[model samples]
Target: MSADALTFDCIVVGSGHAGSCAALAARDSGCERVLIVEKSPPEWVGGNGYFTAGAHRTVHGGLQDLLPIVKNVTPEIAANIDLAPYTADEFTRDVMRLGDGRSHPDVVKALVDGSRDAVQWLAERVHVPFIFSFNRQAYLVNGRQVFWGGLALSVEGGGKGMIAADRAALAAAGVETWFSTAAIELVIDGDRVVGLQVSREGESITLRSRAVILACGGFEASKDLRAQYLGPDWQRAKVRGTPYNTGDGLALAQRIGARLTGDFAGCHSTCWDANAPDDRGDRVLSNQFTKSGYPLGLMLNAKGERFVDEGEDFRNYTYAKFGREIMSQPGGFAFQVWDSTTIPWLRKEEYADDVVERIWGDTIEELAAKLVEKGLEDKDAFVQTIRKYNEAVRAFQAERPEAEWDPAVKDGVSTQSSHLQLSLPKSNWALPVEQSPFLAVKVTCGITFTFGGLAIDPDTAGVLSDATGKPIPGLFCTGELVGGLFYRNYPGGSGLTGGTVFGRKAGREAAKLSGAAR
Candidate 1:
């Protein structure tokens, strides 16, 4: 290595939540110099972490126990909200159940066990303020705020704020960061990775490093990769975050005999606004570009047919997978239908911007007619579907005798029909859409980060060699690059937690490897 050329004790690729955290951990782990290389320009430094709400789904003993972490919560406010204890076992069950027990147990355990600590560690280093997520993760129950779905705290400024806080932490730790610089290849020295080839503004250079941590994201933004792994139709799906996440790290690692893990086709997706630009929407819009209110309403395809069961489970539990289902529907599009009765409780997305495409009407017939004018294939089919659903809702209410609308819990306010039974019945939070004026929002699939990535040594967060069946010395990874933690689905808010959990582990171990290399 040239004496004047840049070098680091540990070099981290990507400046997302995982990469930033890894840099901080490397410094804390006694590494003399840690450098973070971000492919994105300085403006878009945080990857998907900047696009998220920054809500963390972690285990906690409830509001009382979280008082220390969320110091802003007053005692008076605490009495109204019920923050139930989400134990480690519950975290494990959520992960296994969501993944259908397909997620690697070791990876899940590492995430669950280190979750709380991860939040605390980030908090101490970054000076970020965390608070209860009032809008989505909790509901007002019997005049008390009852938190459910195992999601509790969030960074005060959401993802944007959290990213800023992480950047602050990086600067404070004296870590070097390179924005708009991309790592082209991993410089493998025989059996160990010893340096990295990077390019910036058409200039190329190689930087030597004792150890490397790859925290750049997956292939969600690559249309070709999406078609290759997630199917052809996925290429049209709107990207929920940075377009820079085109599987650069994954592609580089694969060249070095890394074994990829999890479902390459499976990704975290949601109901994005149909009118949203093809690329990731601006960071200023942030979490507002998508609609998460489908649970409180119904979704219909171009045929105006109810495709997936809108009330199958809590929105967060099923929203990601359901986006893929929508993409599979005819025209690769769907519309969300709701009425005044459901509008009050829906997650806020209706008021996003003038670009929102929705048809509003005072009556079902009018709504159907308006939808037809907006290019719906079959208005008659929509009318029949609505009538059948409304009839089922009444039947369910009469059958239960004491059914009431409760958002805090899966209130079992469902629908059933004998005359016109739905192939996919609504399971919970089902209310008749009889109230007016009715509304329908056009929606399509918006994919977030992908699940496929390099296999890892769960304990050390070191990338394991597919051929050797052991960790590749001097190589570690975290965030979306570290796979085997998820399969079919993932727990909401667990992405940040997973990054923190493994990022710390990778950083510590990489620092140790740097020492050994010396």
Candidate 2:
């Protein structure tokens, strides 16, 4: 094809949620010809966004305020739901707290302020099937579905549904997309980006464009990059998303003097099923491989010791960092143990018999013995750990008989009290593992996305030049490639919302750049 045929007003790299949103926004903003180029083949399309749970964190006035946008919540169902308002301040605090206060204030403010409008645009414009996250974010308590962790919405079919909706929107908006097109470098015109050089059909081709947006994602899937940036332990971490995100956007932008920022040594990792594929995510099972029930039970390392306070906070807030803790353990794996009391409450999507390998025992001793074959180095240590944990639970229960175990809220049902306290306390929902038919599931670290990425202007999502410390004209970024929003850890559900918010801004700015250049 001729170079003129490949020319576009704006070109977005990556066909994931962020890129799709950018392309659609460019078209809506009056860009005559917008294009998206994805490195992965047609089969591996959506990048890391396809493996997400599709949860989106946004500010709202509670259940009533969200019901109008969600398709799953009928009037009758909404009546039985109790969803507290998630304010902008609360959302901002969650990101800052999880990021250890290293998150850029301006970037975080833009994310928090734009989240609601971005979600609404996704629902109304992109036709993403938004639904109340009943299974993943809510718990049944006294016949009422109480939502916690400031997260209440998800796509209908999780990540798969989200990608489908985005594809449809892109096609409807007349945005052209090309798969198996790997961007090699940003075509630099003096200090500004003018186009992209890409590899297609094993041939290097230069595609001209007035502006470019990088949304191809982070370096979590590259073992070399992970080992180099996040440490050697990260080399063994299983990829929870596409294997295609090997820092292409970061490399491409850095070649043009783009500044790199954010947490290079940190990432969003999670407890994943040990038996799941290590290189790529399973499209059919997708996010179901996550083993997030550790908060509802106990996580013991191979040494049969509790490393973290399992109930330090809600599962949404703590799951990301716990994977790093598990990776630092012997064999880079851990087991989650739950008795009949909470096993029934485990998310069926994650713990179903067909989803993960399960080991069952009538007693704690037998359970520990069974785990010996599955990498538990010391059987006796495992049994003793549970015994001590149960004793602490019982002691706390005796001291606070008035405190009931409510998974829906922080009820102060803890393992530490005036009577006795364990060294590592389950600070909330402390339940004893004394029930018969105990279950155990092995888990390993699943790397979601890397925290290190390109630095961008908070308002326009324009990539900043490392040399000038200013916006690089005609260069923009979004998705996991745009950084400084997170530091050491991440608040659950913020990724998708942040990606869309910045993607919209990037697209509008890029469209204006394209018009001015013409």
Candidate 3:
């Protein structure tokens, strides 16, 4: 290996959002020599980051507070938008609530505390094109765009745009990145990680460094890992991100006795198009394959039964766990049925004719008949299910005439009443699927990232050692590789914000350690 290759103060293993944030933060924190090694080729530079929707959840005082950072909102538009302030306490509660209170308090607190600052840093330093998520998170209510969910901001062109800005920022910071460099092992001297042994173009080279941060992501793409950790059904699940995240960081850390933490059996999965590729994400279409329109409609399994309450909560709160539900259904797939009333409201980016295959039927029975060809086992059961659901909706509407259908808030338009009720109720926004020209889209589970990863110190983002129950010297971790913040389910957009927050911390800490070593 060249002498220059062995001289980096900090070597980051990955080039995703977290790695980029780490490299940039290292340079800013006074690390003179920083390097990022990517396992994928130059074309696949941003790892799983390139496949994200770029939704960033952060603490802010409603629309006014975010106005300064976002580029999409205008004076006229801002006046017609309704967005409530998202407090740190609220964000903290959401993370814990969705995680079934299993999330590590320290990790959750660190993420919540650093969220706003991390977002601002990204906007200012990395020049990420921030915009109000009008198309995805808001709904038209009484001539105003009401942002229902806690999330409200996203990048201009989503993941692709964010990655472009991150790459540019890395270049401006003079951080060198070596593509197609796979981290084979972590080189340790005593208790400190001194360097990395990597394979570049079939040649193994040892590159020395003062500190190393593993942000290479989780084992979502490995079918074997999925079967071993996330259950056998997950082996058939489609990967929603980069195929390169096969637990290399976890494997390297395990070799050195890094403590394993978080939910090994849980992951951030989503309802994706049934036709989407199984092994990897589509770079061109990216996250558009996501099928989150179920909140506005009905999701029926092959048994022609509503397994989950379609409107238990906003899409942001419930989309992540619904994928696991879909995986458990017969044939490991479900159909999202929406009438003309809600069809137009479905995000065009996701439900557009060119994006996903859509099946149309003039009547409920016809839709059921068409769905039988896909995977519906009982056509008669399917037809009866919709009829019963429609009756429940009618009965509820008759009892509570004042209960209006509002998607912006959890409008109590439910299918359950004291007089007449179904076994499983559509809790909110339960408009009957009776409108003509109904639409149904086939969907399957798409695993995003695994929740099982290395344990770390929330303050310094240092990987914790299993032997001593302390921070591993000269080693740090961030991104999806550092877990203990999520379990069972994940709140939408928190992943990106958490990555940035901990990535920034890891970078600064690693840089400090590097200086001390020098």
Candidate 4:
């Protein structure tokens, strides 16, 4: 391939979940020459999708409830996939609750409507076994097959099996896979996306296509971009994933007049050890809050003062606390403190290996020492803080009877309180940190995705021009690129679900346009 020229019916840039699905959808829809250009080699699965917890949301009830077509979805798929029974009104209300009045109603509705079909379609291609966990109200599909193998397989099938099946299916459909190829630019003709300029092993190639899909991902890895978008406060965030997602596609699209949506970015909150070095020496950890339950203890800055409500949605609170609050603090970091009772629960309950290690200290004193050793806190200040906290806890408990004692713990209970102590001790209240051998772990908030991206029409998933309020010709977007669609609040797991739902729409539409052109 040379930088001079190549041609295809459609070009999909980035091989993450969205790009892969778009590529497959184009080929499956009868485009003869579809190409998937991936920057990473085949061996390296894209980090974001691969490491995700794989939660998805779909609406249920309303007029669709009476449609036979909707009802006809297999029991297995329905059972595995939760239908939240959201009426259009209810759905809109829920989105609005999170979106804070900024969401595009049409796009929100489209996603709610399309999720069922998307799940069914993806399930049909992959052997997704539905598990009835978390009660009958919720459903769980085996995403590991999709994540590991790229296809659905029997219980015995591993990641290799799924990947082979997915690759084979694409190959059989004649979707060209160009691993180790990087898309450097979007070839634009006026306001329309015409092709892509790509590079591989020092070679540059221009692949012309009727449509280009910019699914390259957000700027989670770019420190400069993070500082610019998330404000100067983000200078302390730890980059948790791959270094490759530097917003190349986003930059190219913006340069070509693509409109941005939402604010600079969004983030997830959870416990991560600041001490552990990632493969790149970037100090960070994973976002696996569900497994850990919640950090039931108090979190404080270097000054050893309680900040945000520790019991807030462990996930969302992490974002609000670390991303917005703590990151802006004097030191740009914070520490989590808990008693001996909390350590065992944290170790057993939290899934992140880093968090478990951070649950050190037999007493509040030991915990303070550990934090000081980690260079997260000053020894004298931390010790004084704990002494004050212990005094507060004792005073609070004295004010209440033992029979009336309640740890006032929310989110999760410390192991000592739950396992060692039979009941909540008013003595353990989160007032002052006067406990002995306390445990503290340093943590920094890092970004996950840019909430702001190319603005698109909610109804059609087509990129919108800010000036004209019209769709960009021959262009469509999904995932993080569709902005204002989720302006203020996010429906749980809507990000990935939106990607699947709208990526399918974009692919099908692009394929239709390509076929019509032919």
Candidate maximizing lDDT: 3
* Runs off by more than 4 Å, candidate 4: 1-5, 60-95, 128-173, 265-271, 276-295, 314-321, 340-356, 376-439, 487-491, 516-518
Look at candidate 4 and tell me the lDDT of residue 286.
34
Return whichever of 2 and 3 wins on lDDT.
3
Expressed as tens digits, the lDDT of each residue in 243-336 for candidate 4 is 5667876787777677777756554433444553432223122333222222445666776555655544323213322445556655766777
Tens digit of per-residue lDDT, candidate 3, span 90-129: 9999999999999999999999999999999999999999
- Whole-model lDDT, candidate 2? 0.92
Task: Residues 344-365, candidate 1: write the lDDT tens digits.
Answer: 7765544433547667899988
Write down the worst ten-residue block by lDDT for model 2. Answer: 509-518
Candidate no. 4 TM-score: 0.74
Give a tens-digit lDDT track for model 2, residues 234-268: 88999999999999999988988999999999899
TM-score of each: 0.97, 0.99, 0.99, 0.74
Looking at model 4, how many pairs of residues clash?
26
Candidate 1, position 144, lDDT: 85
Off by over 4 Å in 2: 516-518
- lDDT against the true structure, per candidate, is 0.85, 0.92, 0.92, 0.56
